[model samples]
Target: MEKIIIIGAGLVGSLQALYLAKKGHTVEVYERRNDIRKQKLVAGRSINLALSNRGWKALKRVGINTVVEKTAIPMYGRIIHDTEGNTTYQPYGLEKEAIYSVSRGGLNQLLIEEADKLENVSFFFEHRCLDIDVESNTIIFENDTREIEVKGDRIFATDGAFSAIRARLQKRDRFNYQQFYLPHGYKELTIPAGENGSFLIEKNALHIWPRGNYMLIALGNNDGSFTCTLFFPFEGEYSFESLKTEDEIDNFFKNVFPDAYELIPNLSKEYQENPTASLVTVRCEPWNYEDKVLLMGDASHAIVPFYGQGMNSGFEDCSIFDDILEDNNLDFNKAIPEFAKTRKKDADAISELALRNFIEMRDLVADESFLLRKKIEKKIFEKHPNKWMPLYSQVTFSHIPYSEALNNGLKQEKIMDKIMAKPNIESLWDSQEVEDEILSLSANA
Candidate 1:
């Protein structure tokens, strides 16, 4: 078996290590942070991730989905909170359909442990990759007091959005790269379980406090604590930059997300302590340097977390690359080229979908007209499930190509725009006339 080198022991890197190791290769996963399994904070975790069908499929391929399922909490719909603390529940799909909420740190550690079961899989903690020589396939890593150079037959860079490996490759001629950051940033907060580990709010739904320009969402953990995140603008009249003092922060939460503010007793403290992380979308061309080095996951196409596909899409990359390798007889020359070319468009599609979803989640979810549109769409979907799949369902519930989903969504959007433009659309959204219009448009789609 060929020796392989993988960078970044985050979720994608760890899962990729598991996949490659099971292929009977000597796989070394190099991570910058110390082993999370050994960390005290990793005992519980931070920012819980939403694992949809894509993520579940990848994990199941590695034979660990069952274990993951045990720790996951199923969220069948979105429980949207209005300014007055009233909630509107919107089911994500028909009965028994749901997305899962899983702890990022716990999942990563589990993946690492499972991969460690294979004697060929090894992890080098605290070894940060500094640079790489794409020509010779040699990587230099700083470990403690020394720098170590390693040469492997194949190298996979799963080192997140700001990857050290990708940074080095960006210096090459003819390489294309673009990075864009949203005006908003996210800060993670927590709502601990009640005195007896009881959920303070609805446990089976993803809770959202949609406030037009910004929003706050919460996902529950098996430990009964809810991992909450606030997506706020970095600069504005009411933004993170303006909320400087503790009073300003607390008062902001009280007036904006009163219900959530009451639930999170440590809101001000968490707001003060947690750093606000920026959201970025990364797009690049030719996610590989010939067949020697390949970039997967966020290293290639990092997207915003608005659609909750950042981790899912990255996990999907591992699965797709694995398939390409198998189909090409485990030859890097054949597999890498195909994946780089074929996966680029899908990654780009999801990036756009994610940004669009941000607006829908933060603004449209609370609008009356948007609600009417949703009701009409849902009615259409129920009547003709085969003919119409909502864009969100298509992205989250199926393995349909992201490019196809985006294209189809665009068609549906045009049709819906036409329908919504009709006079008194809000009053007649459920009328047969509206249904016929949607049916005619979707039939072509």
Candidate 2:
């Protein structure tokens, strides 16, 4: 078995180490932070992530789906709230099933513990990798209080955004990269469980309060509380920073999310306590440099959290990487480029789509015209079950390519416009035709 070094014992890296170790290889994981499982609460940085079918499938492949499912709260739809506290439930799927609400820290801890169970898997916490010697295939780490070098034939970087490994690879002219920061940023706040430890809203749906240019979203936790993320533009007259004072935050919450304020007794306090986090999308070409080293997860493609696929995509990356390796007769060198060439387009597509979805989530979902089209689209799906599926369905529920989903969505939108223009039965979509088109579109995908 080959020796492997994985940097960053975050969710993806931890999972990778477990999988590789199980496959009979020696695996060592180097993490910059303390062992997450030792902590009682998650770090107060990122909001909870939504894990859909994409993420579940990835975990299922490693025989941990049941464990993850136990921790996840099923979010069947978006419970939308208006300015006056009017509420509506927008179902994510036609069926009763929904996307999952799982804490990033909770999932990471679970994976980390699972990896530790592997006899061949070893972990080094508080080990920060400064750089890697590409030629020697060795990692230089500042472990706790001292610098140490570890030798390995292969290294997998899942070091997250602003990845040090990706930065070093750029110096070798091994790959092209781009990082784009959205004008908007997200700040997380909490609606802790009520005094009796009860959930304020239904525990089975994602809750949203969309206010024109901004949106407040909450995902349920197993502890009977909801974790909310407030997304707003970076520069504006009424930005996150602009609403500084307690009164300003109270007024903002009171005006836009009155229902939410009642559930969160100290809304203003929480807002002030939590720091605002920025959103960025990372794109890179050729995810690996020879079979000796490779990158995955946020280190390779970090998309905005709006689409709720950041972790799911990263997990899928591991699945795809494993497949390519198996296909190439377990030849690491041949597998790396094949992995890069095959995965680049899909990765790029998701990054773009994730950004595009921000507009739909924050603005368009609240628009009447957009809602009308969405309703009609749903109707089409009912009439033509096999042929008509929403773009969200394809992306979240199916393993369809990001590019194909966008193309089909655009096509459906055009056809929807034509149907709206005519308002006649003749203009109604033919279910079989729609099915054939979608099938054809995804056949090669």
Candidate 3:
């Protein structure tokens, strides 16, 4: 069995540790942060992860999904709040299908706890990664005051977007790296539960207040409170910068998001006090180094969170790599390079998709034309469930590869453009003629 050393005890790393330990590997996980179960970590920009099919599948791969289900709150649809206090509902899928809302911190702690239960798995908290000797598969870490070196058969870098491991790899020749930051940033706000721990809004839905250029979203938590986030630009006419004072913040919310404003009692204070976090998309190539070292999760590809797939995709990386290892007869030499070569395109496709989804979520969700197109798409999906599925469903509710989903979405878009161009489409969107046209177009696509 290999002696596997994993960096970063975040969601992905901890789960990975469990998977390897169960396979009889002597797994060691080094985390920069204190153990979450043993510490009181202040709530940060967790933004509440959406546990879709991809994430659930990964959890199930390690035989822990059923346990996780107890803590998750299922959201069947999105509740859209418009500027004038009007609301519209968009179901994410057919009646029974839903995405789950899970606390990032809670889930991370649970995974760590589960992994810790195994005899062969060891967790090193407060152990900061100093550097890596990629040539020898060795790591130098700082624990409190002194530095120590640890050697392993393989090193897995699951450190997040600002991975120290990936930083070292970036200095190597022939390594490709890029980072793109969206003009937008996000801040966490809250809509606390009412008396008796009752939800102030619909508990079974994801809440969205979509403006022309910005949006506010909320998801229900186990404690009945809704964690809300406001996505706005760093600097612009309508951005976080312009709303400098409490009055400006209050007025903006009161005018644009009347319903949500009424629910969030600490609107201005939360706006002024909470931190504004940047949105970044990170990409890198050659995720593995000759079976000695590898990059997983955000270390290799960190996409914007608009698609709610960042965590899901990371979880998927573990499952995919595990499968590759089995397929290659547990040969790291074959598995590492194969996974790196094959999964790169899927990761890049999701990155592109997440960026595009931001436009649809923040702007098009409330647009009349966009709504018509969605209605047409939904009808088509319902009628031809076997032949067609909405892009959102495919990405969120299926195991379809992200690259294939993206290609299918592009073809569907071309068909939609023509179907939307038909005279009086707004009135005849539900007609059989439109369905036939889409079927014919897709056949040729």
Candidate 4:
């Protein structure tokens, strides 16, 4: 059995530890913060995550899907509320397919607990990573009392976006790194459950209020409350910076999100009390140094949350690594570099797709053209399942590589542009001509 040292006990770290331990590795997880289960979670940081097929596959591999499922609320569609309180529902997939809303802290704690139950696994909280000796597979950490170094046969740094291990590697030669911060920032609020423990809105759907420059989204929690997030620019006419007072906060919501404004009774207080957090896209190359140390999850590629794939992608990393390990006969020397080469492209693809989705979510969801296109795509997918799948489905409902999905999505867009351009197309959206045309175009592409 190999000695594996994992940094950060967040969602990715905890899940990876479980996977490694199940593989008979002696695993030790070092976390920088206090045990999350013992502390009240900080707001804004505990953003609800969408658990999709990729994440499910990972949890199933570890045989803990049922444990996490108890806390998950399934969302089958997006419920869009317009400025005038009009609502529209768009199903995410055909029939009863749905994504799940899982609390970040809740899921992380559950995974940690499961990992702790394993004989080969150990967790150390409040142990901050100082640096790493990459060549020797050693980690230097500072505990409450003193500093210590621990060596492992292999090290996996799942330390999140701003990883200390990744920072140290950046100083070395040929380690490409770049960070892009979006102008937008996010804040959290709540739509509390009604008296007698009932949901205030449709409990099974994701609620969204999509204005041009900003949007508000709410996902259901098992406790009958909804975790609402407001995504807006840091500075603009309608932004977090511009809403300086109680009146401004009130008026902005009253005008832009009238329905949500009514649901959130303490909008003003939550607006002022909650902190606004920035969004960043982090991309780095050479996710490994030799065969001793490797980066996984947000440490290698941190993406904006618009696509709802952040946690799903990280969990998928564990699944993919497990496959690579088995394919290489449990050989770390062969698996490490192969993983870096194969996963990096998919990571970059998701990063770009997530950024693009921010625009679609914030602005295009309410557009008539966009909705019409969605209708046509859904019909096409329903009729010719073999020929076409919506980009969203390919990303969320399947385990296809993000790189292939992005390329195919672009081609599908080109074909869709032509299909939508036919005069009087909306009136004949369900016609056989449209179906044949889509199949023909897809075949040609």
TM-score of 2: 0.93
Q: Write one digit per residue (lDDT tens) for candidate 1, span 328-406.
A: 9998889998999999999999999999999999999988878887888888888899999888889999999999999
Clashes by residue pair, model 4: none
Candidate 1 displacement at residue 369 in angstroms: 1.2
Tens-digit lDDT track of model 4 for 266-330? 88998899898899999999999888888999999999999999889999999999999999999
**Model 3 lDDT at residue 94:** 88
What alpha-carbon RMSD in Å does predicted model 4 have with respect to the real structure?
A: 1.3
- Where is model 2 more than 4 Å wrong at Cα? 42-46, 423-445
Error of 3 at 204 (Å): 0.9
In the range 283-336, model 2's lDDT, one tens digit per residue, is 887778777888888999999987898899888888888888889887878887
Query: Which of 2 and 4 is the better model by lDDT?
Result: 4
User: Between 2 and 4, whose TM-score is larger?
Assistant: 4
Q: After superposition, how far is residue 375 of candidate 3 from its true place, in Å?
A: 1.3
Q: Please identify which of the two predictions, 1 or 2, would achieve the higher TM-score against the true structure.
A: 1
| Worst-scoring 10-residue span by lDDT in model 3 | 39-48
Q: Which number leads on lDDT? A: 4
True-structure lDDT of candidate 1: 0.91
Models 1 onward score TM values of 0.97, 0.93, 0.98, 0.98
